[model samples]
Target: MSLRPLTKFGYLGRTYKFFNGETLYPFGYGLNYTRFKYSMVSSSHALQLKFGRLQHCRDLTYEDGTARPPRPTVVVDDITCGKELDFEVDIQVQNVGNVDGADIVIIYSKPLVGIKETHIKQVFGFQRVFLKAGENKTLKFTFIACKSLMVVDKTVYKVLPSMENMIVIGDEELFLPVQINIASCQN
Candidate 1:
């Protein structure tokens, strides 16, 4: 599968509607024999200030003991920029069906800045949870506002402050709004 954002498909994404038009299935598409319901318990609509960019990211190790670069890491202290904004959302998923099944929860992000030549939306996080019939679970996700910073022309990387960052769940069926305010650092 193409890990590049859905919008990168160009005509395939627009004309074929691979990610735009009406389709039978879309990215991260899956089906389960049971029904599931999702509810927002708490969501952060504002960003919290932090000191710097992410540092000391450990390589992700698989079950086979292989390591992968770009391991997930938390933001750390740096002085090049002002406080970094952090956002998070908590969601509750319940299996209301009669039999046990698994459901995959996908998280997508859209930056509302005027950045040109970027994906319509990008998938930031996802997880699969299995639950018994009528079981429910709570999942929490933390994303850095700077994580969505875009690199254009393979040389310039820019962070757009005051950009409306939206956290969408499950095909836009649900979403939480968060704003990144780092106007002091913007040029």
Candidate 2:
């Protein structure tokens, strides 16, 4: 006799709905009593703010077990092909409501090219920033472009560069879009 593996459900479970027309208040859903606005700031370095330091900022090996040198952090507009780079986005969130409240900031990333079997979008990081009425705060999110290419092969995990990476930020009503190019590393 043969038996099937058990299935999971809920937020991070495999049976969760992540697309349109499926359901309301999908994953990472939160309600706020106040209104907030988000805007991207122009800066030389993608990661300009120094409020907190990144815990993991280092080079990673490829699937073939080859070591690559660490790439320098540069402005988002200057990223080119063949360069392993780390970048960040600075978003300003303002509480335009009349009362004090908190807003949960969620960050998600998806690969333009599908990697056999993987989630449509995965949460990489998130932060909950509390703001008083008419208060504005800037949150910086830094990410290594290549680190999003993780894949599971058999029982071992490997990192492979994707053609393009799509980053999304969950705000009040707007979803911020940021694209990263990783074509050069695929060759």
For each candidate, give its TM-score against the true structure: 0.65, 0.57
Model 1: lDDT equals 0.57
Clashes per model (N, Cα, C within 3 A): 0, 0
Task: Report the number of the highest-TM-score candidate.
Answer: 1
Candidate 2 overall Cα lDDT vs. reference? 0.50
User: Which lDDT tens digits does candidate 2 get at residues 1-187?
Assistant: 1021123322233432123225566677777789888776634332221212322222233323444444322222233323345667677889999999998777676543323333456676688899999999999887665454333322233433323445566733444444432322211
Tens-digit lDDT string for candidate 1 (36-56): 888887764775443334332
For candidate 1, the TM-score is 0.65
Candidate 1 stretches with Cα past 4 Å from truth are 1-22, 48-84, 113-115, 148-158
- The Cα error of candidate 2 at residue 7, in Å, is 14
RMSD to native, candidate 2: 10.8
Clashing pairs in 2: none
